[model samples]
Target: MSVTISFNNVIKKYNDKPVISGLSLDIKKGEFFTLLGPSGCGKTTLLRMVAGFNSIEGGEITFDDKVMNRITPQHRNIGMVFQNYAIFPNLSVKNNVAFGLKNRKIPKDEIERRVDHILDVVQISQFKNSMPENLSGGQQQRIALARAIVMEPNVLLMDEPLSNLDAKLRVDMREAIKLIQHEVGITTVYVTHDQEEAMAVSDRIAVMNSGVIQQVGTPREIYQRPANIFVSNFIGRTNIVERSLKKVDNRQVLIMDENYQIDLDDITQYAEEIIKVSIRPEEFTISDTSEGMAGVIQHNVFLGINVHYTVQLSNGENVEVTEESTLGEPLEPGTEVKLLVNKEKINLFHYESEKNILEGDSYAK
Candidate 1:
């Protein structure tokens, strides 16, 4: 059965150095939760904690209502898939998937039944008799997944399971893995450093940095309204600019630059003098009208469906902008342009905290 996983003030240390400190989170049953971040951020460390592979120096990790701190990995009945396929190289696809069931001494017929069913579920049944040496990297990974799921474990943990695959194959396997996880309806804790992979597969994502969870939210929430400057910069391409806010004629106006300003409605009265803003590449609208922020196009890259333009603002900072590609040729370098930002979509942060002030008006407090 699927189970909820909880981390209560969890801590992990190595050689007396704390790697993860006071980390607490709840993962719902049957949910695809991903721990995402760059290398050395403790995401994998935390995942290993859940799997009982790593020791917990402090706090508790629970599955449903059971405390798992002292539980052995074997007793945990958790399914784990790793970056390496971890399938026996000498075994056929069918045998690889049946290895776990066989080890448990399950009845021969039952093992055959389960092996057949899961192989189909992961779409590798056609390669059942094929040896691991003959199967593609993606196919072998499917065997790993099928073996993990066939046991019907309480939780499934995948650690950088796709990192070894080529770019195109990584995309394909991630989609397949997400689909298989849904079909199994098992609680899954996925760990990955790839942001796009996490966004694509996770029901909720906890973005980690320096052993801390920077933000926990759906892909859209994190991408649209990141918790801080780090999250905004990590998830996608954004132009973070420092701008001044001033009360102009009884209104709070944010100066995008000397040439452009936007009214900060409602909470404007409480805003600080200096505001940090994260404007995603798509948030900027390019126009020829001189009324908006002044910029000059430095270069352009054509990416089939979209054209990415590098614009140097009048103040000398360069920002990337994305626009849909058209039949017309892209504008050449040295083109003068005007840029307008989507006020509602832009995010404002506190200068000192680097935290999204729009999360709750800092001045209003």
Candidate 2:
């Protein structure tokens, strides 16, 4: 069965410097939660803390309400998959998966039964007798996964398990891992620097930066409604506008570089004087009959499903616009076009604090 994991005001430090400070999060039972961020963002640090590989300088980590701050790594009952396939090369697939159970002094029959079942679950049953050297990278990864899941720990932790695989194998193995995790129904905390990988496999993501939790939400929420400038730019391609907000006849208008103004009817009236707005590439479309801001297509690239265009506005700022390839012939460089945006989809952040103004607006009392 799966267990709920909680980190309560957790802190970690190296020498006198803090690496993870006052981090707290709850992961639901059987949920595939991911810690996503770039290197030095403390995502791996958080994962290691959960695994009992790092000491907690303050607060506590618990599994199903049981404190684990003082527990040793082996006693915590957590299964871990590493970036390097940690299976033994000389051992056959069956022996590698059985290693954990054997150490526990499980009965021979029980070990065979569990190992056989987990191998099948990971779809490596046919290679049970094959040595690690004989297996492909993806197969070896599957063996490592089988080894971890065979122990049936309370929680499963994976640290960039697919990073060593080739591009196509990463894609294939992520799908495989997701399926196996669902079958086993274990609480999982995955760590990865790849935003796309996190989005593809996680039920929810905790975006971290500089030892702090930035935003925690479902993949769609984090991507579509990022909490700040860091998340907006990190999760995907975004065009951020540093603009001023002013009330113009009962409506808020976004002023771009003291020149162009776009009416922000959906924006709250309590918006700050200056704010940052995030617009995704796919949010812009070619307007019909000059309905919106005019821009010159600086360049265009034809992707399979969409044509990406770099549009230079009159203010000398460039915006990326992605239109469906079905929209018609791709616009050539220097082509004049009118770009329209979804007003409601535009996200606004506080200029100073860089927090999501919309989220604050919802919780404002």
Candidate 3:
């Protein structure tokens, strides 16, 4: 079963300090949407509100065009998988998965049939009789998922469900979750602080910060074109170049720093007072030629598949770059080198407002 979930102008607070403020979003039926942010950013609070764990202050929540504000959590038909994988330690896997159905007073034969079917879907049918303590962390997690899904809830909410497992296991488990979610086609809202995980699994991501959603977009869109300085800096590694803009010629502005000057042409409507420019690490290329910008190599780090080089620009700015190869003689510390900045790859932001004008007007607010 699937239904569209909507949070319209949602607000939540404790002691008058707003945890979630006028947050609005919509999760499509059978869509995998993620609420991603750091701790205290209100992602969990928003999720709890949807789960009916927390009360909404000044907004409305609806499911399938029905007002859910007064609905109890149980009656909401919402399934949730928490970080701890809450399962009865003493109960066997099969029993644990069947517990929810039993509580709902389902028929005995139908309960068994449904439990067996879900166990097979989770690939834990053989371990159904095994206690949770006897299973690996990943197995236990799967059991938790099986329990939630067996209820056939209209909406599934997962709160950092893979956080307890090891890194390798986390990756594997998410793949399983994605596959199972696809087969079940349940509308899902996943909450997490891990950007990579959100990007990997979500159909859309709402990046939250300071009790507000900074941006919402697909993984590629959010990564390639951030909404603001905070979004760019948080989503990936970027070198923020602080500079002032001066009109150099007709329809062109010169980006002037302490030791470098680059021409910026085809300025946008909001590019009147450029304060900062963000460039991704991969956008820089090191060479022997004295073109573009000049910098001194500070350090080189080799990570097998990629090489990270820290370069100190002539303007006393240090920037890190990731290269494809560390081969062919590395640049030692304090070595002078030239950097080629991909001008087209630069992201310009307003200084006073601290907003990326490239993202459009709605993003500025």
Candidate 4:
């Protein structure tokens, strides 16, 4: 059965310097949770703590009602897959997948049955007898996964399992991993520095930085309503523009460079001050006739599905914008245009704290 993992005020230190401190989190049973961040941001440290590879300096780590701070790695009933496919070089695909069960001394018939089932589950059945040397990187990873899951461990830990594969193979394997995880129904804690990969596979993601969790939520929540500026910048690309929020007609009006005015809210309480606006590329509408913010297209690149544009606003600040590819030709670099912001989708942040001022379903409650 899958187990829920909990962390309460967990702390880890290196040479007396705290690496991860005061971290408290909960992972639901059978949830695919990812620890995402840049290197040295404590994501891997946290994962190691969960695996019992690193000692906790403070707080308790628990599996359901049982405290695991003193548990040994081998006794944790956890399976691990690493970036380097840790396949036994001397063994064939079948033996590699059955290694764990064989160690546990399961019945010969039971081992064969489990091996066959998992090889098929991972779609590596055709190469069951093939040696690790003869298989591709992707195939080797399949062996690793099949080996881990065949034991039916309650928790699965994967640390950048796709980092060694080629780009296309990474995408394919991520999809494969997601489907297999749901099918097997095991609680997962994945660690990675790749934001896109984390989002694609995780049921929920914890964004960490400098040993602190910046935010934890579903992909959509973290993207749309980030708790702070660091989170808004980390999860995806955004254009942060300095703007003044003025109360005009008793409504919150976002004033840009004394040239553009857009009403942000009429109900939510916002003190009039200089604020930072976080607008995503897709949250902008660009057109020829003047309707909103005035800007000149600086450059344009047309990808197959969308067109990317860099526009220089009147204040000389440049912002990126993305629009759907159209039948019309791409706009020239010097072309004048009007940029319309999607007020409903934009995010406002307090200048001093850099925390998102609007943090609810519709910007703010």
Off by over 4 Å in 4: 363-365
Q: What is the Cα root-mean-square deviation between model 2 and the actual structure? A: 2.6
TM-score to native of every candidate shown: 0.96, 0.94, 0.92, 0.97
Off by over 4 Å in 3: 251-266, 270-272, 326-329, 359-365
Off by over 4 Å in 1: 266-269, 359-365
Task: Between candidates 2 and 4, name the one with more favorable TM-score.
Answer: 4
lDDT of 4 by residue, 263-342 (tens): 76532667588888899999999865557888899999999889999999988999999998874788899999889888
lDDT of each: 0.91, 0.88, 0.85, 0.91
Q: How well is each residue in 96-137 modelled by candidate 3, as lDDT tens digits?
A: 999999998999999999999999999999997898989999
Each model's Cα RMSD = 2.6, 2.6, 3.1, 1.5
Q: Note the clash tally of each candidate.
A: 0, 0, 0, 0
Which candidate should be chosen as best, given TM-score against the real structure? 4
lDDT (Cα, tens digit) per residue for candidate 2, span 1-365: 68999999999999969998888899999999999999999999899999999999999999999999999999999999999978898899999999989999999999999999998899989999999998899999999989989898999999999999999999999999989998899999999999999999999999999998899999988987888889999998989887788887888787754434677655665644878888899988787774667789999999989999999987788999999999899989998888777766778888889887763332222
Best-to-worst order by lDDT is: 1, 4, 2, 3
Model 3 TM-score is 0.92
Worst 10 residues of 3 by lDDT: 356-365
The total of clashing pairs for model 4 equals: 0
What TM value does model 4 have?
0.97
